[model samples]
Target: MRNLEFKEKMHEYSIWRANLVQAIEMYQQWLTRYGMDDAHRTNTLLNILSSLKNDRITLAFVAEFSRGKTELINAMFFAESGVRLLPSSPGRTTMSPTEIFYDAEGGSYIRLLNIESRLEDMSLAEFKNIPERWTQLELNCDSPTQMQNAFKELIATKKVDRELADRLGLWNEREAATQGVMNPDTVEIPCWRHALISFPHPLLKEGLSIIDTPGLNALGTEPELTLNMLPSAQAIIFLLAADTGVTKSDLEIWMNHINRARSAKKQGLAVVMNKIDAMWDDLGGSNDYDRSIKSQIKASATILKIDEESIFPVSAKQALLAKIKSDKELLAKSRISALENYLSNDILRDKRNIMASIVMRDIGSLINESVNTANTALSHASEQLEEFRKVDFHNQDMTGKLMAETRDRQSLYMANVENFQSSRRVFIVQAKMLINSLAEERINEVIYAAKHDISKSLTTIGMKQNIRKLFDDLRDLLQDSVDITNETRRLVKAIHKKFKDEYGFKEIEPILFDIKKYQLELEEVFEEGEAFRTSAKVTMTEQGIVVDKLYSTLVAKAKVILGRAHDDAISWSNGALSPLARQIKDHKKQIEGRLQMLRKINESKGTVAENIAHLEAELVPLKRQREELAIMIKSMQLEGQLAESS
Candidate 1:
């Protein structure tokens, strides 16, 4: 229902983000209208707006087969469909990792990637961009039956010979036999490796993305699920069957992927004890399963090493039935509203804070820079107006005196300009060295070396050794980057101090490039890589599958992060000295303009009153700009505070 608590909260969050984006857009227009935008600053602002426009609160659903992950999704967000949205039937319903969200461009569609794509070295991320690679099926959103039938494709499977299954690393003899489903002739594997569904659901339309992942075998084989998608989610809901408590496979998924994906403090993690209705005692009182649910919650917390507060016990099937039949009593018994409240309040609030931090990181410095430049210009304008007002127009000697003062100021500024040019040459040399070290060519060389070594390795153990060596090389690259970054910071700092001390420039600190954040990111990547390297699934997988998984997950992911660091370095070097340099240039121009104005009056071609009026006209806009800039900054601050407290 539109009045559902989760739906209402999601709507509120979307409106809040939309309003913030409007404020940001207005600021961009204000900068352009005032002729204050530079190439670098404008590009940065555009990038920030792009991030905001595409922002979504993503929650990943992770579990072993039949933990009711897809069923919970159906109850929580798609209950309005009045039937099961995703095919969450008995055993391995969602065979592949499926992402459900609204795509503005594609509208409504079911895009499935063929499982054969896993045979390639490309990652799921790369495959997403190549639309032709996906089998696009029309999704009739207006017809729930049609949509439900189409979703059955998510659970579609094809039988392949055991040899083919082994090559694909989907035939786990031990795992299959343990489940008593061993077959020598044929093995069933998902028809698709990944599915991307762009549906026009209301909550999804409000920038809510849901990832429904498969069982432990899939989690182990598909590194991207653990290494990329799971971590990127703002919240990860791990499902466990309440009737079975926490099984060995459930605990395996917890320890290896879900536990490793999050922090020790367990932020953004919710363990859902689904199928609580199965534990309901018909012979007992209304609160029959209350004690049973609480007992299992404590047991799950202890086994998973998370707080009991993080575990939610709910009946997805009952919740869906309640909503469909408009039965409030059943819904309460389902306890689905509690989980809905958590998603609405807790998860959405946390997501807002994360988004706020990103906005602050990207645009905060640029805003400060704009404010500083405007203040300095306004101050200069006031000084010019004061000097003109003090002039005695009838005293012709006054014009020559003003001209002489302007010339002296110009001489001092030009002296510093000459010194800046000489030091700039040295700065450019050091900057090149810093950027070249982070160049694509250099990054590729390391990647190529690692892949080549892995390809050459004859045995699985040798391949594992090669992967370890690659991480060492990657870490070494990061360390070298850190050293160069520090070197550049010292060089830039000395140059900044030079201009301030020698030229009487106002105190302004250069925004130095930060490599520590990137280092920390790479360190986490290394930890995950090591975990993957040592995982039994990876080591025991076929060599080709191992290579494919490594390329798509560990190697491809790191390369992307490193690529970002390089782009940031380029942006930093270009804009590092811009604020100070612009000020120097502006100061020189102002002095020259004043001298020209005085010469006109001294030559009897212009009146002192006319020049003073011209400066007065300029001051009006400058004053208005200052007011607007202050308002914009205050609005962002208030919005960020509200995000935290709300």
Candidate 2:
């Protein structure tokens, strides 16, 4: 017996199947005069039909440089050296965006994007030699051992020679020139700057894709990371070194890139107060110090307008090293335990909520549609079979005539049937694979790259100087905005007081109204200024990533293909297939017309599925951020109460 859920699902599927049948009939009539091959045309129709599937949720990590982003990734994903994605040093390991996903049969695959390759069937080591393009390739494997070997091979193949690195902007050419290196030979290496790895992980398999973006400045500089990737994220984890607290860059990031784009109803942001081990000695297990730290956290949250609970103070470096050495004792340490608990509980909870919402709304409908379309095609095939069997081919003495008619009818009917089955299989497989791939890719490309690059950029620029400059700029802006607000308030007050005195009015109603208006205007100006600051920061990040052109191009291509496929399917089914049968030929045209109407319905279903998938992916990060903000808001209220009590 079918369960209630299954029955309901089947009902929904039936509706879609009926709609699909009508579309097929219409497309056949439209294409009858064209004499196109039934097999090829039906294949095209199936591809269009498959678009009515749902997408999955993908989680990504984004933050500023050198805040232990990569260390956190290692702690979370690559505890074993053999499982690591990229070589983490004090400088950049990834210069481009990469994605990783899982393959069918529960194995892992690595897919590197934007790499130029000349050789077919290249090994992992050979990936390094490819030029950079927007193309991608896939590799298959499983287990930590396999992953480790693949990583090693990739690194070996793609290792940037010091001389080549300098020329390609990975290393400082000016510094090399100063060292008396003249006329060094340049190698023609592939422009492939990013690596993508796909792995089978429990969380990822469950429809979560984690993306780790580059450092703060890097994120800010990369427009694609923000406009294309970050906005699409379900949850964003912003990491700040605990010792530094929320630095100017962190503040800038929040105000500019994160805060505005976030949905308050959805948990969208979490601040990871990392490198807490550095503060361990200073804390000294003192209640006073703990209280002080908590107080400071609250104060910071209040100023930043963030939730305190979302601020997780952790030592990513210690956690990663502990995991790497497989030291159980170290892993059990309070700091490590705290971080782990938070991730498993608070983070996971938000992820679950987002997933549930998506499943109920988007994925559920898509699954139903896919099943229905398959059933509809099956029904049509059954009808065609019945018709073929009833035909009196035996009475026709001419074997050639009988054979030709049978072949033509069988070819057309079988083609549509085969195409439908193939499409259903491919859609289901690709959907699952895309989800798994995104998680592994993010860990390798964003997290690892940020870890190395942060340190390198800091060292190159002189950390103290750069930090000071960032702080000075932030402080000046904050002070200026505050000063302007205060001045405006004072001016409004003075005008009200003067007007009341001159008019000899005790109520001063008109003056009060004017003052209120001026205050509102002032508030608007302040809001605009805040928005401007955020936009400036986001713009910088966009410049760094160079994703604007890429995103636009991809989106455009997807739209065009999807549209053309849908239109072609409807035309072929309605115009080509309805004019053959003697008794039903006129009725066939009517059936063909029904197929056109069915096309519109199926197209709407496809659009709905796409929309739902996009929303589901977005909800995960948004919910997490919202939860973090809620915690900070509660902390701020508590602090206010304490200050009042005192």
Candidate 3:
């Protein structure tokens, strides 16, 4: 069974996700009905839902050997099995950085990467590409005893000659001297480089992933863990033994890896002083135990340079025993709830905020803009419909006056057509000029510059920093493409101003050919490029492949991107002018028909009722469209409000 607190958190999260899904569906329907193109926004929403479907919140545990990190995991998530579900014996068990999560598609199994495979000069990521290189073993998760026995592989070690150990970066001469083994012939090393375990557990099934990492030595060997996985996790729980607080290796792990990974975002770090039960007192006063624990917490906080409140003192063994035996007093004494509360309240709340921000920024803005645009058009249509209804068709003087106005309208209509032609020619010239400025040649210039920068970086020792600088240059160049966008925008405004001020066309909205869409896409591409370059475990040969792949893909896509921009510029220029020109012609035709009707009524020669009826019939659908549009706008507005409140 899951803890009550986590179950509550899951319930709230599910509700939030369900509401977001509903809003997305409603927006999609609105777009389809209105014939609006929202391919980018719709795709973004789908990706969000897909991520939510696999919504895993990872909590990583980092500690040196036997700091009770494994025991904490067993106590918090696996105590229901009535045994330490993972190997948490007295000696070291977690040799490699182990990731445990429920993989419904992968089945119940353990996958291990052999240490000898490192001799291939391949990174872990490259090793993953060749699945035949790994050792796979099936596990019977249904049997606790079987799982216990299977997990003993974590503690399995091998004896290697001192020279082989040193070559593998496993031997420490100073440590050997301290242990009085200065002339040792052999050294111990972990058998595997990494371990992956997949099983069905309540918390794991609920999208909870746990990363159990070994001490500083193992972390030093795997750069990806420090660079990628640890930073990506929602929370990193660094465990320390209360009996032996702040060891040299613990301080090294904190200062180098864990702290560095979360330097940019400090929300993920948490320290746990585990095995507090080891400080129990029988002969001393009750206050002595409290004072001792407080001293340890203070000492740890001072050493770690972290807030005192961030340290949580807990007894995992007592917590596990208390929960299994239903001992509430012992559970309270264990102080496990303090850490669980932080996870449930603070960490999970931050995750929810992040998810909510994505919804607001992407989907919420999309819905708001669409609804506002529809409302504006509907208002214009309603006002025009009212003006049409007021046209009399019976008054003789009014008919004569309207006939004169129709003739005048014809002249105005010709002027509008001429203005449209003149404006379109000017706008098209400017748009094509802007498009030419943002042409493939310009893009290639930037691409070549980036290529040159990246080439220089490839030979640098600080590969990660160089990769970042490469992407920084790429982002700056991509942003330069927006200059063309700014020019095009100014031209569009000038064209819209001509139509509105000269012809009094207030119903038309600005033609929006958004260059930011392309800008955002490029941003995503660069972010992924950075991730692959900096964190991916690619060998030198694979690094060359990565660079070539990026160059080819980016250059090819750049052509298509600029080509689409050119096409959209031309299309928008044409489309924006055509509507107002059509409206002018239609108004002229309506006036001409009214003039003909008035002539008949004034001469008292024919019935004008049929003409009036025809005009009225045309308005019926316009009114209906306005009504439907109003309903959709209201619904979308309500959705936005609800999302904000959520």
Candidate 4:
């Protein structure tokens, strides 16, 4: 797996981020010197800087047990270890969700939260915030033996009392019977609820995080994984065995977690058909290996109802063995290179563009505001200075005329500022109302209610009808979001018209408000939801798998689907009004500039000239700063375009 492109892209983002921070810092200092410190604006800039500093691209691996998922990760990322770094034997090794990344500030350590912590009813995120709640083990990267020993903690299991197991929902008599662990007095569970491993891998050090999640049972119990981590991930790799194809349990995981949690727009989803080495080749040169792999890929794609191209046939074991032995021929046959190319070219490229869009949206707006403020202040100061120099003390009549005209002109300017103020207020109230209608809390409530209604409706009969109604309700909610976005766009156009035509406000552009893209995504999800319900009916007819299991899977999958919808809705609504928000801020700054002009005009006659001269002198540096910022923004955009093309 080559990460040359990924590394270069990240480096570019780092440079752009640093430059933006420098600009913001300089602007903040300039504001402080001018006695115009705005805490809200400073905090906003600081928050952006913080986000840039902590940005990470997450690649999440998910699958049913024994699909060689960890083997693939070790091959693609840990080839330098010269052996398998993660346990990937025949049975379940990763019993809980494990995250691997380099914690540059915290140094190397393995942090584990005890399984008993789950009983406390606190989330994994909350548990993480309190370091005292975790067990931390320092890691030594210099010693391979120590690193291997430390990693064994990921596989550690403990015997739990039957009563505790039952309370923790780990003991299901019927499921245990199916697994052939019948009539157990005690159950074995992972000692840790989750694991965080920090090491000095090249990718990890470069802000790449990998999440290794266990099978269905583990995911079914972790609400934080389903609700937070998975959805926030940039990409999700669903691993399946090529020999067995998509089993009932694999379908459960896919429907319940992988497909439902991934964003529809980003669509950062891939299927790795692992264990391709198991497909036997015919002795008579019939090309059976390729044909068998192709057949399995087609079957799995149809079963999952996803694009055929997204399914990759790979031999994880062969890939790892080939890498360790430095066998180039075997490595080529492993097909891991194709998957790596997909990640570097598709996933990382998309991430770069997304990061660029955000940087342009926030940092670009900031720089633009600084330029507008500086220009307004500079222009006012220059005009006042020129007028002051024109004042003739030798001629009292000329001075009187000049003073009267300046007062009249100031009155007109003040009236324009007042109108701008009132319009800005109107715009703010309208924007707030529009934004609140699509609030995250409100959308989450709608999703939860739909999930609740659908889950309650999933019985043996009339299940289809109830599920359809639930989808209809969701469709209506999505339409409501669309309506809100459209209304906001309309109101923004009105505001722009009033400011540009009535008040001569410069640089007014209509905000881009399009929830139609997100609406379509929701529509696609609705279709998928319908397919899920239909698939459940089909599963009910299949032997060995019970209807209750199908129903439970449907409920879990529906909840995740609804949750992703809420996330997209909130993101769309918030992003839709960002431009308008910037414009509103610009209007506020313009008003402040006018007020400053009025104050200067009302100052003592002697100091007004000095103040104007000082303000004029400040303009040269401010203009230079604005010019430099504009060049930096253009360069960043160009680099983003190049990265996208590459």
Residues 83-169, candidate 4: write the lDDT tens digits: 677787788888779999999888889999888876564557668799888799998888766887888888899998887886565
TM-score ranking, best first:
1, 4, 3, 2
Question: Model 1: per-residue lDDT, tens digit, 181-277?
Answer: 8677998888998999998888888899999998997887788888888988989999999999999989889888887788464778888999998
Report lDDT per candidate: 0.84, 0.44, 0.71, 0.69
TM-score comparison, 1 vs 2, better candidate:
1
**Tens digits of lDDT, candidate 3, 1-646:** 2356775785676566666566566556656675553455556557666766777789999999889899899888888888888888888778888999989988888889987654444566566677688788889978988988888887779988887776555677777889888878888888988888889886677678999998888876565577557877999999999999999999989987888667646696789999999999898766999999999999999999888999999999899888888888989989999888888888888887777665565455455545444554455445544554576656666666767876887788788878777877876776676666566676667667766666656453454555566567556655665676677677777777777887776545554567787676556456545555654333333444445545444334444556666665555544545445545655565556556645654665445556455545655654554566446435433445534533
Off by over 4 Å in 2: 1-55, 80-86, 91-94, 105-109, 114-193, 260-266, 282-296, 321-329, 332-646
Q: Cα RMSDs of all predictions? A: 2.9, 23.8, 8.1, 6.9
- Top model by lDDT, which number? 1
Show pairs that collide, candidate 3.
none
Candidate 4, superposed: residue stretches over 4 Å from native: 1-37, 263-266, 280-286, 373-403, 416-503, 507-623, 638-646
**Which 10-residue window in model 4 sums to the lowest lDDT?**
542-551
**Predicted model with the maximum TM-score:** 1
Q: Evaluate model 4: give its TM-score.
A: 0.72
Q: Which residue pairs does candidate 4 place in steric collision? A: none
Candidate 1 global lDDT:
0.84
